[model samples]
Every structure is written in structure tokens, then in C-alpha cells.
Target: MLTLLILISVGLASAHHSGEHFEGEKVFRVSIQDEKQVHLMHVLANQVEVDFWKPDSVSQIRPESKTDFRVKAHQVDEVEHFLEEKGLTHEVLIHDLNKLVTNQFDSLIRSSGHSYEKYNSWEKIEAWTGQIAAENPKLVSRSVIGTTFEGRSLYLLKVGKAGSNKPAIFIDCGFHAREWISPAFCQWFVREAVRTYGTEIQITNILDKLDFYVLPVFNIDGYVYSWTKSRMWRKTRSTISGTSCVGTDPNRNFDAGWCEIGASSSPCAETYCGPTVESEKETKALVNFIRKNLNSIKAYVTIHSYSQLLLFPYSKNYALTKDHVELNNLAKAMVKELEALYNTKYTYGPGATTIYPAAGGSDDWAYDQGIKYSFTFELRDTGRYGFLLPESQIRPTCEETVLAIKYLSNYVLEHLY
Candidate 1:
């Protein structure tokens, strides 16, 4: 069954060609500090793209006013003007529809000689994982931690040498669904892990001494929706029970300072925090798994895309953590290592200070759980491509990311007590 999915995905990807068109709709990326503000702002706008920074539906505000709002901006300058005039108080960037390109590294990988037999649907990724585990049983094992709202299996891959007690690193991707680069990075991480295990000293050392838990796709239902119905779906597909609104931002549903400053309470708002903390099954599953493994999990690393940032925790506000200095230093070192490969610049800083205040994020949750080395990597295109990053950049982005991860992992291994 998984094999069939891969074949279908490969065929679809290979048949894909560029120059296809969207509505040429004007899109503006807006940031609102409060959850209510996100709701009110979205309610007032004409046509807005929340960019998965916020949740959808399932909010703290009344559902009656939740709606499709659009910012008045057809061009970048106009967007700037709108931002200046509105005093919106959140970061708003206006962009046109000319940026999405399909010719990227993942696309190339799908169309390349890697066997259409191996490149199928989202299910097939698990099949590939199974095959890898079967062959390298000592270093790879598959675990079904929980199930998604849609009942899809949440598969986790624990990769490392055969051992009982070892410091571990936790990595997850595709929490936002639209950030396709996240899953691509997870796949790339697996590929690199397999290829460089015995070759690279640092990688080999880390793998031999520590375990890596990789969750390739966190929001499976939403990810499938992005591939099929809407390429921009940002939350899970679970219905909000009484309302017609669907999905909640899983990232915003965590219990860590949830729905306070950076999240929303309106069901129609993009950053909707959900009915309550850990309302989404997927979020609960991840939270429980991390909590169970909190002691040995030395670091938590999540991959997101199109921001070109290496951000550390405390995203809910601007308050600095005790390890801020060490985290910042490591981010700088990782950026230096990443830049050596592709010359792509990555802004490294505390999350709230670097981007905006985002409450209840997985990184912050992990940090609160005592995992100090928690980081989120937002990869590629400061705005050149947005969420529709072309496939051509996958290899370079993943390659540089691998360097950064390896550097960080080595640092963890050396300092581990």
C-alpha cells in the first residue's frame, strides 16, 4: 500500500511542470500580537494569508465575527503604506503572486532516478522508513507513538546505533502543513544520516553515542490537504465540533503560555489556540512523547521554512531565558557553518525578538520541559519564494542545515555529562 502511494506521488511529481498559474491574488502577511487582535484583524481585512503563524478556527473569540479578511495591498509599496497607516502593530509584509516555483530539490528528487517505486504518497514515506529499519535494525526502529485526528498513524523513527542509554536529539517537521520544506528536511536528514554515518567523524560520533528521533510529518491530515485540496492549509483537519470551522494550529495548542499573548481565541482566526491546551490529539501525542523522553532528550530541533532563521525559545514573549547567551552563541556558530556551504544568510536570535511573539510553540514547550537546547530552523527565501519554495533549493538548504545540525549535535555530545 505504501509502495503504491510513492509510485503515485512520483508520477504526480514527474508530471509536474512550471509556469502554472494561481489567481494572481494579492497576498499580505500580517502579524497581530494578541489572539483577539488576530481575529479582529482578520475580520476586518479583505483577503489575508495568515501564513500558518496562527491557528485556524477554534479560537477564544466568538465564532460569529470570524471571517475572511483581506488587507488592501496589491503591491509591496502599497502593503507598506497600509501598514504605516493602519498602525496595525504587527509585522505585515505584502507580496504579489509571482514567487512560487515548482522546480526545487524535492521536486528534482521525486523526478530523479530514485525509483518511482520508492517515491509515493505520504503513506509511502513510512514504507521507506520501514525498509530502512528492516535493513538497519540496529540503528533504526519504527514506533507508533499515537494517531492523528484523521486516524492516520503518527510514526516516529529512532535512529542511532543499537544501544540502551544514550543522549538523544528530537527532530520534527511539517507542523504547519504548508511548510513543505520541513518534511523535505526530515527526509534529507534521514538520507544524510544513512550516507554519512561511517564517513563523517562528528556525525558518526553523535550517532554512535546518541539517538535521533525524527518525525517527518506532524500534521498528516493538513499535509494531505495541502497536497490535494489547498496548498496553504495550516492546521489539522479535525472539525471543531459545534462550529463549521475546521482545524486548529497544533503549534499554538501546546500548554506553554498558550492563548495568552501571541495566540488567538476566535475560531476563524489563523492563530486560533484551540478550545483548550492540548486539544489536538497530534499535539498531545508529541507533548506526551517528549515528556516521557525528557530526561535523555538533550535537544529539540524543529524545521520550518521560507524564513531563513535559526531561532531559539521564549517565543511567547521577549523575556530572555537563562541559557539565552549560550543559545545565541550556538546559533551564530551554526549560521557560520551553514553560510560556508551556500552563502545563504540566516538570522539567528531569540524567537520573539527575531520574528514575532508566538505563544505555545513546540520549541518553547520543549524548553519549559527542561530541554535547554531547543531550536527551530526556518529555512530559505526571506520572501523571494514564500511558502511556495521551488524544489531546486532543497539540496542546498538541506545540506547547509545538515552542517548546522551536526555542529550542534557535536557540541551537545561533548558537553553531555
Candidate 2:
């Protein structure tokens, strides 16, 4: 009787664990051959719980572009049949999403120490911020920019030699919650900066002339939610009146273009623009800080994932910026430098023409504020892993990206007149 009771308890634990994740969900990559097909797919998505993995929103879908979406176990057959009936060309990218989700956690063993081979939880990262700043007093300092919706302190690391009235570059990562690799790169960058400070000539020069404002994780509440509740969570953790949804896409909550294109007003949408511009505390905090230092801040760089592209301003529209020629040339040079490390190719251009028109992006808004060097990086493998970028690739991704950032920073420092 004792053995039977123990066996029953073990069985119940296994069942409960399985129910916690996305069991049996499949990810499909569909090709949009024309505008009509894109509309049809959008209509179908409205009927079921479809999660768009790429292009992010239905409005960004275009002809000759590929779209990735996930369907739950119950809706798999219906979604597949509906696509087939519409003559949409589609294939399964991930057979079992839960398996990948399980594998994501398997790579990390934090008992040994903080390892770059795994995604660190919020608690670990918070502790790391304090530890790193304490270790490098002269070169790095930590301060709270603001508090997230859930009251978590948003920490920003100011890295440079102690000086006054120096030009600076502001970099932020982890805008979307599930993009774990985004924050990983930011942490890796801080490590690299401290590790190679005086030894690396280019890094030393950049640090000497310009301060680096690094926000390790921008969407703190959403990032915490992604870890504790949903792995696919992608917005802020603010509550809205008259709606059951819990968050807004902080990326789409900025003031540039103000939800004119490639954003949704629906509260339940993954790309939901909040009730008003800068509605999220996270967005407002960053905006306020940047505005306060507008004269000294020369550039802004926001990091994202999955698409291997470097983008500039005007993501809200096709109109070119006043400094388009210089921006394009600099981005071209930076991407060229980035490819040298791992032979990794990256496309570069204005955000709208380069990929899709995404309004209210922080990058575009920063450019409108007169930061000519504002840019956004979409990092890593195009679509194979998507948001669940494996831990194995973390080191290489950060190492190669460092080259591009340095190249751009050097250019910006030299051009500051």
C-alpha cells in the first residue's frame, strides 16, 4: 500500500508538469503569395487562437513573405485544413513546441555559477547587475531608471570613465518579453566592455570619449511574466480597464507615428498599442531619461531578435529621413564588420523598406528626437529557433554583435562635431 501511494503521487506530479507548458502545439511557416492570401489568413486567425511568430502582426504580412504561427493541439487539424483549402503553401517548423520549451531549460545549470550558456532568470540578472557594478566601481555604476508595473526596479548601468559632459550612446535590450537572447546580449556586452576596457584600443577610445547607457532589460514586468507564467508573453504587465488582457506591447507604445501602421488597437493583440502614446511606465521612463539628456545623447540602439537585420529610422512610413544617406552608409559598414567574425550575413536599411512598417518603435522615435545614429538590431538565426534561441548560440551571437556595435560607436564618436 505504501509503494502504490508513492507511485500515484509521482504520476500526478508528471501530469501537472505537462499541463503547465504548451503541450502538442505545432508551429507552421506559411508563404504569403499575395495580399488576398494574407487577408484570408488574418480572417482565419481571428476565428482561432493563432500566435504569430514572425512579422509579429497580421498588418505586416506581405506578398512573397513567409509567416510563422503556432496552433494549439485542438485547432491543429482545423488550421491545417483551412490553409490547405485556401491553397496556402505551408510547412511545419516545429513539430512539438513543448519539447523545445523543455530543451530551453535543460541547457542551464546555475548551481555551478553564472554561465553564458543559459538564460538567466530575473533574480539572477538582478543580482548580477549589483555584483558587476560593485566589482567595477570606476568603469560601471548601477542606478534605477524607474519601477516596472509590478514594482520591480528597472536597473540601468552607466559604463565609462568618470567624467562630466561627455557624449553618450544609449542601448536597451529585451523590449519583447520572450526574446531572452536580447537581454543575454546586453549582459554579455557589459562583460565584454569590462573585460576588454584598457586592453582593446577601440573600446578604450570609445569609453574615454563617450559614456554608454545600458539598460539590461527594458520590459522588466513582461520579462518576469515570461519566465514565471507564459514563455510566449510579449508585452508590459499593466492592467487596462474594461479588458481582460494584462499588458500592452511596449514597443508599440512609443509616440513615433502613434499606432498609425503595423499596430493593433485591440487590447488582446500581441502588438496592442496601449490606450495612449507612452502609456507604459517603462516606455515613459526611458523617454523621460532620454529627453533629460537629449543634448548629450548622440545615438540610441534597441536590440531585438530572430530576423538578422540592422534597421534605421522611419519604420512608421516609407519616407526617408534627412540623414538617410549617411545612416545607410554607416549601417552598411557596420554590417560588413559584423559579418567578419562568423561569416554571418545581416541585411541593413530603413525599417519599413527593410522588413515591415512598425509604428511607434523606440528607434524611430529616438531618431525623430534628433538622434541621427538611432538604430535597431534584429539578431541571430532568421527563423529556425525564433524566440526560443538555444543557449548554445548565445556566446557566438554576442561576440559577433560586439564588433558591429563597436564599429558604429567608433563612427559616431568620430562624426560628433
Candidate 2: segments with Cα more than 4 A from true spot: 1-19, 106-113
Q: For model 2, what is the C-alpha lDDT against the true structure? A: 0.88
Best by lDDT: 2
lDDT of 2 by residue, 153-272 (tens): 999999998889999999999999999999999999999899899999988888988899999999988888788777888999999799998899998999999888999998988899
TM-score of each model, paired residue for residue: 0.81, 0.94
143-237: candidate 1 lDDT, tens digit per residue: 98899999999989999987888899999998987787788788888778877888988778889999999998899898887766666668888
Worst 10 residues of 1 by lDDT: 61-70
Model 2 residue 14 lDDT? Answer: 35
Best by TM-score: 2
Error of 2 at 127 (Å): 0.9
